[model samples]
Target: MTSSDLCATLDESDALRLLRGGQFQLEGRLVDASNTTLRARLTLDGVTARCVYKPVRGERPLWDFPDGTLAGREVSAYLVSQATGWGLVPPTVLRDGPLGPGACQLWIDEPDDAEALVGFVPSDQLPPRWFPVAGARDEDGTAYALAHADDPRLAALAVLDAVINNADRKGGHVLRGPDDRVYGVDHGVSFHVEEKLRTVLWGWAGRPLPAEAVEVLRRLAGAVAGPLGAELAEHLTTAEIAELAGRVDRLVEQGRFPLPPQDWPAMPWPPI
Candidate 1:
C-alpha cells in the first residue's frame, strides 16, 4: 500500500506493532539533522509504511543530555502525548533498526495543498488569528516574524512541549498531517529534568489554559500517577519522570500557558 493508504488505515496499535516488528530498509538520511536520522520503509504482516529511524549508535552526544539516550527520550515524549489524549505526537517506539536500537516513528505525509500552521510571515502582514513570537530580517533587511496560528491543535502541542520540556521545537518539527491531525516530531531533545521549553508555538503564552486542555490535564494527572508513569519508567530516568509529573501538576494549578524562559534562549536556533 502507498504511504497515504497506510496512514489512513492503521490505528495506534497497528502502527506500534509495525514499528516494533517491521523490517527496515534505509532509503536515505536527513543530512541537516544534528544526529543520524534515516528515512526507511517498514514492512510487516503485508503492511508497508514510511518511517524515520534514529539509531542509538548514531546519536551525537550533547553536553546537557546524557550520551546515547536521545532515542529513549523520543519514545518518552510520545508516551506523554498519548497520555494527554491529544495525540500531538506520531506513534513512536524504541526498537532495533538496521543500525541499532533507537526510535522508529511513523512518518506523516503532508497533503499537496496543506496549509502551514507555523512559519515566517511578513513582519507587518501577520495572518489573522496568528501570533508573532519573534522578529527577524532577511539578508537584504526585509523584516519577517516567526509566528503560528491561533490553533487549538497547536496549543495542545504547546502544552505537550511544556510537559516534555522540549528543548528544540523548531517550526520544521511541527507538521500538518494528511490525516487532518497536527503532529509534532523530532523530540529527541525533550524530557530534560531542567526547564528548557522552546518553540514557535508561543502564541498562547500567559493566556488562560483552554478548558479542553485543563480537562485533559486532569485525566493525565491520574494516568501519570498510575500506569502511565510505570510505562514511562521504561524510557525515562526516575528523576525525569518525576519532573514530568511535577510539570503537569504545576500547569494544572497555574491554569495558564507558561512564559518563555529568561535564562535559556526562548526559541531554537534557526527558528524555522
Candidate 2:
C-alpha cells in the first residue's frame, strides 16, 4: 500500500497537532529506510521520538537477490517484539499513516539522553570474507567504546536472536536500558535465510545458555498457540509460525545450558 493508505489502516485522526516549534518539534527526517527497513521521526505531542515505520506491502519478494517488503518485515518485527518482550525490541506503537511518515509508531526515545558512543559502528563492516565489503571501517580507533563483557545481558540477547532467526543483531542495535536493562533493536531483516546474524557481541560464545533465558524462550513457546501465536498469525503464514514454534522448542530442550553453535560466525563484523 502507498504511504497514505497506511494512515487509514491505523485509524489515526487527521489534523496534525502542534507540540513544539523547533526541529525536534517539526517533521522528522527519514532515518534509515533501506532495502529492509524504513524509519522516520516527528513531534506529535511534547516528546520527541524515533520510529522505524514498516508496512506490509503484501506478498514476499520473489527474487533471491533479496528485496524486503515493508509489511512482512514490520509484522514480523512487532510479533517477535511482543512475543519476546525482555526489552529485546521496540514495540509497534500504532499503525497509522499521513503523519510525518506513512506509519505512526511509539517513538523510541534515545538511550535516555545517553547518546550513542562517540562513534557507533554500523553493520556494513562485517568480515568481507563472510560477504564482500571493502573499506568498511575506514575510520578506525576508539571512534566508539565497545560494550563491556560480563554483562549477563548480552547472553540473553544472543538466545533471543537464535530463536527469532534474526540475522541482523548489530552491536549498536543492542541498547543499554534504564537500570542496566539491555535491549535489542532492528529486527526487520530477521527470520530469513543466509543466517544474517551480524552482531559484534560474542564474548560469551560457547557459554551455556542461562536458565532464565531458557525459561523466557519456553514461555514464548507456550504463548505461541495463544496470545503470541494469534498475534503472529496476522502477519505471517501458518508454516512460518510452526517453524518459529519449533525453534523455540529446540532451545527449551537444551535445558538452559545449550552451547552456542560452533558453526555460527564468531561475531558480526564491523562490530556494530
Candidate 3:
C-alpha cells in the first residue's frame, strides 16, 4: 500500500486493538544480527495488517539494557514520537503474539527503489544540501565522509532520537515511502535513562532546530510532564520517564541540535 493509504486506513485505536487482540500469522523471521524479529500479518475482525513482531522470548540479552525490555522501549518510542506530533514512528503496541508477549509494530510499505541517502563522501566534494555526519579514514589513511539527507523530516527524526535517547539509528531504519515521505522504524533500543544517543543523522548537528521542530518540541515538553509522562511510566522505569521529560525540556530550552556527548560513542557501529 502507498504511504497515504496506510495513513488513511489505519486508525491508532484500530491498530492498537489489532496488535493487542489479533491472531498473528508469522510470515518469517527477519534476518538481523542482534535480535529475532518476525514479519507477520495480524488479522482482526476480518481486517488484516502487515506488521513486525518482536517477541520478548526471542530478544537477545544486552549488557546495558534490562532483559526482555526492548519491546517496551519500542512502544515507548512510538508514544513519544506520536506525542511530539511528528508520528515519526509507525503505530506500535505491546501485546501477546504468536511467539509470546512482545511489540507489534505496523510495517511501513516503502517503495523498493527508494533508499536512504547515506554513505561516505569526500570532505571537499560533499553534495549540495547533504551534510556531513562524521569524518573517517579508509585503509589507505584517506579521508572518509559520512552524510545524510537535508530533508526536514530527517531533521525531525534526529530530534526524536535525541528525546528518546535512541541508541541505534542505523541507515536502514530510515525509509522513503511510496508516497515520498520518510518513515523511521526499528526502535527496539531507545529511551534509556543514560546518555546513549548513537545515530547516523548528525547532518544538522550543532545547528538550530527548525522552527516547526522547535514548536513540536515545546508541545512535547508540555505533554511529557502530564499525560504523556503517565503513559510512558507504564512501559519504562520512573527514572527513564523523568529523563525523557528532561531531554525534551532541554531541547526546547536550547532550541538547537546538540553536539554528540564527548564520552559516549557518537555514532553506532556499522554506521550505515
Candidate 4:
C-alpha cells in the first residue's frame, strides 16, 4: 500500500504491530545522517509501509551517550510521546532488521507545499506568531534568524524534547505529516542522564505552560511512576528514567516552559 493509504487505514496499534513484526528491505541510505540510517519498506500480513531503519551495529559512538544505545533511545522517545497522548512522534519499535536489531519507525510523508514550522527567516521580517531563537549570517553577508511558529502542536513537541533531554532537535527533524500532525523524528540522541536538552523550538521558553500541556504532564507523571517507566527501563538506564520523572514533576510545579540552558548551547548546530 502507498504511504497515504497506510496513513488512512492503519491506527497507532496497527502501525506498531507492523513495525514490530514486519519484514524490512533496505531501499536506500540517508547519507546526510551522522550514523547509518536506512529508508526501507516494511511488509507484514500483506500490509506494507515505508519505514526508517537504524541498525544498532551501524550506530556511531558518541561522547556523552553510551554506544549501541541510540536505537533504544529512539524507541523511548516514541513511548514518552505516546504517553503524552499528543502523538507528536510516529509509531516506532525496536526490532530485528536486515543489518541487526534496531529502531523501525513508520515513515511520515510530508506534503510538497507544507510550510516549515521551524527555519530561517529574514532577520528583520519575523512572521507573526513566530518567535526568533537565534541569528545567523549567510556567506554573502545576508542576515537571517532561526525561528519557529507559536502553534500549540509545536509547543507540545518542545515540551516532549525537554522531558526526553533531546540534544539534537534540528529544524530538519520537524515534519508536518500529510495528516497535518506535527511530528518529530531523529530522536536517537535523546534521553541522556545529563541536562542535554537542545533544540530549535525554544520559542515558548519561559512562558506559562499551555493548559493542555499541563494536563498531559499530569497524566505523564502517573505513567512514569507506573507502567510507562517500566517500559522505558528496557531502553533507558534507571538514572535516566528517574531523571525523566524529575523533569516532568519540575515542569508541573514550575508551570512554565523551560529556559535555554546556560551551560550548553541553547540550539543544535546546523539548526536546519
What's the number of clashes in each of the models? 0, 11, 0, 0
In model 1, which runs have C-alpha deviations exceeding 4 angstroms? none
Tens digits of per-residue lDDT for model 2, 94-165: 354433322234333344565342123344433222221112333553233334344566666777777767
Displacement of residue 155 (Cα, Å) in model 3 is 0.5
Candidate 2 deviant stretches above 4 angstroms: 1-33, 36-50, 55-71, 99-105, 111-148, 177-180, 193-196, 256-270
Q: What tens digits encode model 1's per-residue C-alpha lDDT throughout 127-188? A: 99999999899899999998899998999999999989999999999988878889999999
Instruction: Pick out the ten consecutive residues of candidate 1 with the lowest summed lDDT.
Output: 1-10
Candidate 4 per-residue C-alpha lDDT over 130-216 given as tens digits, one digit per residue, 9 for 90 to 100:
999998898999999998999988999999998899999999999998888899999999888789999999988999998989999
Q: What lDDT is obtained when candidate 3 is compared to the true structure?
A: 0.84
Residue 2 in candidate 1 has what lDDT?
Answer: 77
**How would the candidate models be sorted by TM-score, starting from the highest?**
1, 4, 3, 2
Clashing pairs in 3: none
C-alpha RMSD (angstroms) for model 2: 9.1
Per-candidate TM equals 0.98, 0.63, 0.91, 0.98
Q: Which digits, one per residue and each the tens of the lDDT, describe model 3 over residues 1-272?
A: 43346555777788778778878788998886468899888778887878888989999998899999999999999998889878778889998887889988887787678766777877788888898878998888889788887988898889999999999998878877555767788887898888999999987888998899888888888888889889888889999988988888899888899888799998988887
